[model samples]
Target: MSTWMIYGANGYTGELIARQAVRDGMAPVLAGRNEEAISKLAGELGLESSVFSLDDPATVAEKLQGMELVLHCAGPFSKTSRQMVEGCLTAGAHYLDITGEIGVFEMIHAPETSKRAADKGVVLCPGVGFDVIPTDCTAHKLKELMPNAVSLSLGFSFLAGMSPGTTKTMIEGLSGGSAERKDGKIVPFPMGSKKRTLDFGKGQQPVTAIPWGDVSTAYYTTKIPNITTWIPLSERQIRGARVMSLFAPVLGTKPVQNQLLKWVDRSVKGPDERARENALSYIVGEAKAEDGRTVTVRIKTTNAYTLTALGSLEVVRRMLGRDLPSGSFTPAGLFGSGLVESLEGSGKFEVVE
Candidate 1:
């Protein structure tokens, strides 16, 4: 019996991770609620699998028994992570998930959650994927360069399509607007409220503030009091986001979400193989001290989904192959900023002071 499992193995991102894990000579148990999809993937990869839903805590815990680690890849994590996290606590299994949701990061990094993970002798690390790994690492690097920094800004430029799960997650949070960290507290703001022009390895482009997970995780990692995240966007897209902000509550309704998700399910197929092969993402981060000193770093990395697969599996391998401490962590908190450059397609950060 394998000690590790990949929940939501049938999901687009989950399947990518599972396949890559197999290619790297690891045999992780594939588990998900979709019996046929899970079974099919398991058979194709020649690995064990379990089928279960997260609706029942007892059932989830029972299924998680004997698992030392579980890579949760299902979403929207707002609805799925709680059950999995609780089950991992009960089963004494270390938990890792590829979540970039600000709320999910805050939930997992809360003091109570950290205490429970410590008591159970398990590590809980979310956002091990594309969501925050690069940005978090870059932020950590900037902190090292400017130890007295009081604020940090992170941004990325990745022109990739979203998976159905990702789309659904966005739909669920449409009403929440965007978020940023101020004085070490997470605060919500209107969508597209802030914008910046940064050179993400490419030319200068306008990036709009987004409710990226770094708004929460970066605070935990760097203790930076103020943090804002951004993504490249066109003027039209910025306007669209502002207009959408007005209807966030309505768009977040159950009926509206259901209808929108139906369209996502029908149309969203994520990036195809060719796109994944050619995908490149650029990340930029700047840390500014109150005394007017600043440090900025930029990174060029692989595709978001590909990087997610690589980052998650790399974390799993290191955790299983060594004696890392048991506690909650941001990806860079446990692994260090070097983790970003250790990946296959990651380039060393170009620092500018």
Candidate 2:
């Protein structure tokens, strides 16, 4: 049997992945920097556990020795991904992470790392979450329908819930202004002001250009000349995000970001029972062909984090099962349209043309 590792297995999302892995009969090795937490969760789930801190390179490489793949759940990935990815590559293990950080995603696409992973014949898939999967898959689906699409407009309609860690990560990213490729070059954009309303059958809500994983993943997948991703926000949250955006340069300071993260951690719930019951994410994309023809694709799902775990697990299963091409790639290039179909078959989502 091939061994799999679930790093950060004690986190809310991490634990969820661990549970799903066990259910799939994979019996992953639950691992993290915190021994007690990992051990407790592993014991409860009837799985093995290990301790490996990303801060210690040798330890990480050692712990990953026998694993064929790893599902990294801990974030903010901006801080931890490099080391984790390096360790995985050093151990000759396939890697997957649910990272929405544009910086981290871009880093993985860097020439050196990309060449290294390719040369080693290992797979490196990032953004296996609501961020990239739904958007990238939607882009792929649209291209299938329109074949000649040159640009895309994507929006997410989500009313469900957010984990404390996710909230903190967003806050941190917002405090630092986000940049997107515009006219083929990266440009800074205010986190809020670019609002557009999206119809999700129920009603239309104003969405803002919050930096999302789709910005990077879509470029890699569809080769579209332009792509924009938006997320629906309540009026109040929009106001807060706008205000924060105004003072982003200052708020992005280390002390301020740390304070904001601490506050969010205390106020937001990571993943309570309520969140599991109420979570939802709807992604819609519009693709425009050169001749001005258009095609639209939409995907809706519940339990966003659960689906993220499921997506990552499915990717790992495919890699281990010899169903994926051996190369460092994003989800789109690795699984393509088949990924979207698999998620739909999971009975957790619906797709509409």
Candidate 3:
């Protein structure tokens, strides 16, 4: 039996990870609810696979026996993570997911969930993908530079199309509005409620506050009491987001979400090989101390999805080979500030004056 599995092996991001794993010569059991797609991918990759769904925890647990870890790729994880997590706990398998959902991070990090994972000798780490890994590491590095930092801001800009999973997650998150960590508590604000101008290696561009996973995971990784996340967007996109906020409630309804998700399934195709090869992503982080001093750092990396595939595999391989203390952790918290730098195709973190 393979010690690890990649659930959702047929999804866009999942398929990327699966192909990457094969290229890297690591064989992991591919698993998902879609037997046809999963079997096809498994055959193409010449790796073992199993078909299963997350509907029943007990059944999933039984199926997960003998697996040392699961790199969950299915999303919006807000709807799929709970059952899989429960199954991991029962089966004593470490849990990892490429989820960016704020609520999902909070839920897995909750006292009860952490305690259960600890008791079961399991590790629960979420946002191990592009969702939070780079930002979390940047926050950790800045905190090290400004030990007395009281405020932290992180931002990123990526040039790539969204996968169906990513698009559906965005649709579901529409109702939650934007969020930030203020004084160590998650606070909600209206969508596009805040904006600023920042230079993410490029010239100064207008950026708006968005509810990113770092808002939830950064506080844990850096112990920064105040944290905010941003992404560059044009005035038109900002205005459109503000307009959508007015209808957030109706959009959040199940029927509306279902319809929007159907549309996503029909139209959303993730970036292709050429796009992924040509695209790049940039991230910036700043830490402010009470004495009016600040430290800023910027990072350049490969395409977002590519980074996720490589980064998640590195984490998985290490966790499997080493004996990390059993509990929940943010990516940087588990690995260290150098986590992102250790991955291939990642650039050095340049300190800015």
Candidate 4:
């Protein structure tokens, strides 16, 4: 009987989460800035609705009063996360979002907010979506095997294309260059600076270093001083990254970036159910202890979008089942790989000793 709020409930992924929650016979308050869309979705789902913008942090905080949990599905979370997090803290409601932005990880994990969440005694867990849930779990499992691990590496294969929200977020990161954690410090590198041929058990495929949220979260979760996250990329993508690195100065321009985004419809959604069901994802995490002991773990899961729904809801379900105090946590750090293993279409493969 845990109550939840579905923020950005009309957006592509938010819509999916809302539908799945309803399909599973769970009730969540549907909320967003668009009155017409949220109202339509609320009506369709037979749920209550809230329409408000994050323009005023105080007002946004006021609306969060009494909300037990808020599944923030809106993005670019870079722009949205801080406001909602402040609101969640104000209301003493646990905060969770589907953001994979490195900046976001740094923001929520900031000692200031972390302290606030601790004082409020409400949990602050972001990236509950496919962003880092499975991979965070994978890294956690690897760290367990190599307790003194000083370095953590994680990589994943894309299971599907981006939603409009995701596409927008990617555009925002284009000029920022890629980032990673080195010696407990956030460092930048040129796009695709590191490449590896990882075997996902299927075969060896190319993975190029990318600035994923895990670079930020893993250090917090495991205190691993050095971390790098990678993503499978095609030859064409690797080439494009090189080109982008050279042209970042031009592409970073707001006017130029805005034009690029024009081709993608912000109102347009992500993949449909058929695409989600058919898609597949793979994640591998490796950690090296100071003593040279290393452990690698692999996970195969269903569609990225689909897992976002299933994994996030399962997180909420487990939260409702317990009396978790407020504090910052990664999904796996809080619930462990048991959360990931419990999912129907996901699990860890044999550990690499």
Candidate 5:
């Protein structure tokens, strides 16, 4: 039996991952800083629980011992990834995280940490969420269809609701402003910067180039000269997001952010029959080859969080099942275009070109 550990197992996303793990017939060790929450989740899931805090590296390393893999669901990963990565490396365990924060991605990709993980032969896969997976996987597929692709544009449309963590991450990004690659270098784009329209087959909707996890993932994975990722929203929602962007600096403060997060937590709803039935993500991509030819690919899925867990789970299964080279790697490099087919088995996605 493969022993997996789910850090932050009490979080909204963490619980979902745990539920899926049980459904897949894998016994996962639920762990987090909150002992009560972890115990509750473990009891509910009929799994074992452990206590580990990101603030305490020794405890984190101890908790990670003997685990084949760790599914990290806690975020904002900007605050937690370093310690988690260190602990995973120390324990000789594979590390995966559902982080969409570009700053965190850059931090993990730093020379020192990347080299260390590679040297230790541990896998450090990030952006395991809706942020970059759909886009990154789509980019990989597009590149296969057009190997010389020099630029890529990814757009997403979802009628589904967002998780509290997802909402808070957006608010934080809005408050801090967004950045994107332009002219071969990363440049700051104002919150909600660069607007474009997406034709989702159902209809056309406007999207803005907000700072998202994919900005860095695509760059690291594809080495494409340019990449852009966007999520579509209603005009009213876009306006509201823009307004929130104006206030982000003030609300982004620790106290204000905590207050806002509390409100979000209180109001947010977790996945249920109705919510899962209504959730869906439509991702479309346009890749421009160096020869100036453009190719397009489209992928659609339901229940973003479940699909995310499925994607990460599939990666884990593959890593364990195969004789993969040991090293820190990005999703695109590790799975390449095959991620589409891999995810298809999860019964969550469809691809149309």
Candidate 6:
């Protein structure tokens, strides 16, 4: 009976996942660098807590001892994933994180990391949350509808403000530009590579091309050669992204990124339970094959934050109960898009005309 360990158990998304686990009658040990926050949550939930900085690999490895799997919620994962992953590998535990960063997905799926995790016999999965899970699963559904699909597009519209952790993750790569999958390889694109219209059973919405985790995860999940991801935004927002290209050089600077982060920190935190309950997010995936056959799938899920918690917890439960193959994997790659189908609330997907 291996118990789950939730590192970063004090953050917004992390705390949600911890509670979700408890609601399901699972006792997971809480761990993170913030002693006060983790202690308060642990005491409230009557669960054990361990405080350790990711900077200390030895300490991280030690705390992971006897854990079946780790739900890593701490992000700006561009900085923390590697250290935590290293710790997981060394500790012989599975690694699952709620990161939507394309770079982090690429990093974890790199050949070297995949080989190491395979050799260590531990599952290495990233973006098990709202960021990629819904899109990844819809891509999988489209694959079944259009086998041999060569090109895929995913568009999503989230009607919610940024979670503090999510906002920080975005700031971390503010100037990295965008990306797309070409011939099954990740390629860098400028800030606003392209824009298009998507119909999510609702009215039409303008979606702009951006470097989303699906750029990396979908390629591995479906081996699709050409894939693009989009997020719905107003015309003004699209124009804003285009204008950003001109400022890429400046916006990418550490100082500028830091200042932007400070502004975000001062502005707002994340959604509250009511907000999470009220938010509605929609995703559309269109898959096309060389012969011109095409299929489109639309998915609806509730509360981005809540989706992250439920989706991640479900992945953890499966890992504990089943003998999943050890290697770097996206949600669809390991479990197929059906993982989304298993979502409890409004995590529903369907094909549309």
Q: List the lowest-lDDT window of 10 residues for candidate 3.
A: 1-10
| Candidate 1 error regions (>4 Å) | none
Clashes of 2: 0
lDDT of 6 by residue, 1-353 (tens): 77779998988789889998899998899998889999999999999888899988888898888887888988889889999899989998999999989878989999999999999998999999997889989888888787789999999887777888888877767677888999887888777658899997788888888888899988888888899999888889888888878788888888888888898878867888887788888889999989987888887888788889899988888899678799899988888878987887765677787
Cα lDDT of model 4 by residue, 1-353, tens digit: 66679899999999988998988889999999999999999998899999999999888988898788999999999899989998998887888899999999898888988888999888999998888888888888877788888898898886677899999888878888898899899999999667887777688788889899999998887888999998878778887887779877787898988887886673546787787888888888888888877778888888899889988898888786478866888898898866777777986566854
Write one digit per residue (lDDT tens) for candidate 5, span 198-256: 66556667887777666777777777778887778767777777776777668778888
C-alpha displacement of 38 in model 5, angstroms? 1.4
Put the candidates in TM-score order, highest first.
Answer: 1, 3, 6, 4, 2, 5
lDDT for model 4 comes to: 0.86
Name the better of 1 and 5 by TM-score.
1
Q: How accurate is candidate 5 locally (lDDT)?
A: 0.77
* TM-score comparison, 5 vs 6, better candidate: 6
Instruction: Report, for all candidates in order, the number of backbone clashes.
Output: 0, 0, 0, 3, 1, 1
Estimate the lDDT of model 2: 0.77
Q: What would the TM-score be for candidate 3 when compared with the true structure?
A: 0.98
What's the C-alpha lDDT at position 146 in model 1?
A: 88
Candidate 3, residue 289: how far the Cα is off, in Å: 1.1
Of 2 and 4, which scores higher on lDDT? 4
lDDT of each: 0.92, 0.77, 0.93, 0.86, 0.77, 0.87
Worst 10 residues of 4 by lDDT: 263-272
**Which residue segments of model 4 deviate by more than 4 Å?**
266-268
Candidate with better lDDT, 1 vs 6: 1
- Candidate 5 residue spans exceeding 4 A from truth: 235-240, 344-353
Q: Residues 1-353, candidate 2, lDDT per residue (tens digit)? A: 88888888887788877887888788888988898998899899998888878988888888889788888888889888889899888898888898888888878877688889888777888888665777778777777777777777888776557777688788777666655656544466777667777765567777777677777777777777677777778777877777877887787788988888888867886766676667666777788877887776666766677678778787777788474555557786778766855763233223444
The weakest ten consecutive residues by lDDT in model 6 span 344-353
lDDT score at residue 17, model 3, on the 0-100 scale: 97
Q: How far is candidate 6 from the true structure (C-alpha RMSD, Å)?
A: 1.4
